[model samples]
Target: MLLTVSGPPGSGKSTAAAALATALDYEHVSGGDVFRELAEERGMSLGEFNALAEEDDTIDRDLDRRLREISETRDEVVLESRLSGWMAAEHADLRIWLDAPLDVRAERIAAREEKPVEQAREETVTRAESEALRYREYYGIEIDDLSIYDAVLNTARWGPAETTELLVALAESYDPQTDEGTFPVSGVRYEF
Candidate 1:
């Protein structure tokens, strides 16, 4: 089964995805890894690369293209990114969108990055806005839309371990043989 785990920064997406992947014996592929690779390739900071990505559309396209390929061809894999649900499309057996309140997310991010909460909060907000705009312009995707997801989880309500258990239960209970339906993605142009 292909599982898509998507969420904003500091929302415990990476943590949950890692745990879910291990619990289910599935490989985890993250867009963040690719993004970091792109950044390192350019000899630039993440902030600088993010700014460049906003101006140069290909950066995001390249990242999405790789993840999409993995999703389209792989099974028993966990695909994770802010837009992983959409990137996985019909190939995903379970599409999950995890999120938390901005304040909670900022605090989590602060601890992980060893940064100040206020600084994390401001950067998180700015990055989200920038990525939302890029997603809209590049693929006609509205980050606010949740209709495509099978599960929408608020990570603030649970710690990473609890969230992983919940996801494992959700996946174990899913029976593709008696599947209801997979909402088809349409209208958007996938140039990647």
Candidate 2:
């Protein structure tokens, strides 16, 4: 079973995905880690790489392609990324979207990154705008759409531990035999 955890920054995607993988004894693959490595390889900061990626489609397309391949080849893995749900598409057994209000997410991001809340908030807004445009332009995906996700959780309501427990239970009780189908990938335009 391939589980894809997708959410915006500060939405507990990495924390929950790691915990879920440990509890379920599955491999955890993070697209953020991959992206960060790509940034490091280019001798750029994450923000710098994000800016570069906006101008160079290959950056995101290449990263997304690797993730898509991982999804296609792997089972019993937890894949985490903002686009993992959409990238995995039909290969994903359970696609979960985690979210929180922008303010709450901004605070979380600030605390995690050891930055001022105001700066984090501003960056959050800017990054979201950039991503929304890129997602729409590059893949024909509406970043706001939750229709493709099997479950959408508000990570702000519970702490990371509780969120992981919730996902654990969801994975444990999952019975594909009696399950309704997930939404199909539609209206996507893959550049590669």
Put down candidate 1 lDDT per residue, 1-192, tens digits, no spaces: 999999899888899999999999999998987898889999998788999999999899989998899998998999999988998896898888898999999999899889999999999999999999999999999998988888888988887888898888778877766664322233221110
Tens-digit lDDT track of model 2 for 138-184: 99999899889878899888898888888887777665565533222
Q: What is the C-alpha RMSD of each candidate to the true structure, in Å?
A: 5.8, 5.8
Model 1 lDDT, full chain set: 0.87
Listed per model in order, the count of residue pairs whose N, CA or C atoms clash below 3 Å is 0, 0
lDDT of each: 0.87, 0.88
Highest lDDT among the candidates is held by which one?
A: 2
Can you give the TM-score per candidate against the true fold? 0.92, 0.91
